[model samples]
Target: MFEQEDALLTIDELCSILMIGRNTAYRLLNSDAIKAFRIGRCWKIPKAAVRDFLEASHTVL
Candidate 1:
């Protein structure tokens, strides 16, 4: 789903990749809709998790 070869992505990177806003990205994280973990005060999202989320979302729709 993403062209960038990053194992972990930051909130801004996630927003850029998904073409979504920071709030929306944070919402997903807070809701556990997209699996992520916090490193100190920063969130680290796995690329595979994002791919899985996209795939699951696509299937649901």
Candidate 2:
């Protein structure tokens, strides 16, 4: 049910979506916690990967 029209998002877009600072996003991108791809000099994150991360990390209080 988490289908998205766009599979990839720019770093800026990812930061906005995750509500994190650019540096934090970069850190996550660098770490294996999140997967990212480089196209030319820019990095792009897959929306599905983000969704999976969220789902896997979710915990009910």
Candidate 3:
């Protein structure tokens, strides 16, 4: 659902959007629990990757 021209998101943005704490988000990103890439010292997480993660980790409710 992310329609920004640039699909990449910073760690802070990811945390804000996902409603998770910084540590949890970093842990997930660092552990490859979600897809992410680095440019210099910053992370660039794709919106699609987050969507995929949620979809894959969702449980029936």
Candidate 4:
């Protein structure tokens, strides 16, 4: 779903892509709803994970 090869998105980029606030992004990361990894104090998220989250969220519940 990403154009770059193995692109890692920053929290700010993620927030922009999802049109969500920092609090919601942190909640998703903390809640494990969106898979991500930490490098030191920064969180790095995969584009695939965000795509997956969007796909999952669109499912009828």
Candidate 5:
């Protein structure tokens, strides 16, 4: 889903990729599960983190 290596996804971009709302995105950001950082008041997520989150999302019942 990500086209660039070493590219950072903005909060909006992350939300779009995750197909989630702003509040939920922020909630995830606040949580420890997501790998993210901030740049002058904006949240920046690495491209690889998308894959990591997706991979971690699945579990055996």
Candidate 6:
């Protein structure tokens, strides 16, 4: 079960959490690398999706 604190977040919230610019966030969303849901005109992203994106995009040097 997911906690309330771990619930889906809005684009702005995700941007703040990821410390990325709005354009970058929008690009990520557009590319579908970060899963998002459209609610009317706003986009919402689950916390788990963010974690998954970070994991999937991680590169080992």
What is the C-alpha lDDT profile of model 3 across 1-61, one tens digit per residue? 3877878888888988889999999899999989999999898999999988888789533
Model 6 residue 20 lDDT?
97
lDDT, candidates in the order shown: 0.93, 0.80, 0.88, 0.92, 0.83, 0.85
Clashing pairs in 4: none
Over 4 Å off, model 2: 1-4, 59-61
The lDDT leader among the candidates is 1
Give per-model CA RMSD.
Answer: 1.5, 2.7, 1.8, 1.7, 1.7, 2.9
List, residue by residue over 1-61, the lDDT tens digit for candidate 4. Answer: 3787767899998999899999999999999999999999999998989999999999945
Question: How many steric clashes between backbone atoms does each model show?
Answer: 0, 0, 0, 0, 0, 0
lDDT tens readout by residue for model 6, 1-61: 2356757888788888789999999999999999888889899898899888887878531
Give residue 47's error in model 1 in angstroms: 0.2
Clashing pairs in 6: none
TM-score, predicted candidate 1 vs. hidden true structure:
0.90
After superposition, the stretches of candidate 1 with alpha carbons farther than 4 Å from their true spots are: 1-5
Task: State which candidate, 5 or 6, has the greater TM-score.
Answer: 5
TM-score of 6: 0.82
- At residue 32, candidate 5 shows an lDDT of 51
Tens-place lDDT digits, model 5, residues 22-60: 999999888956788998999988877777877888652
Q: If ranked by lDDT, best first, what sequence of candidates would result?
A: 1, 4, 3, 6, 5, 2
> Where does candidate 2 have its weakest 10-residue lDDT segment?
52-61
User: Which segments of model 5 are wrong by more than 4 Å?
Assistant: none
lDDT of 1 by residue, 1-61 (tens): 4666768999998999899999999999999999999999999999989999999999999
Give the winner by TM-score: 1 or 4.
1
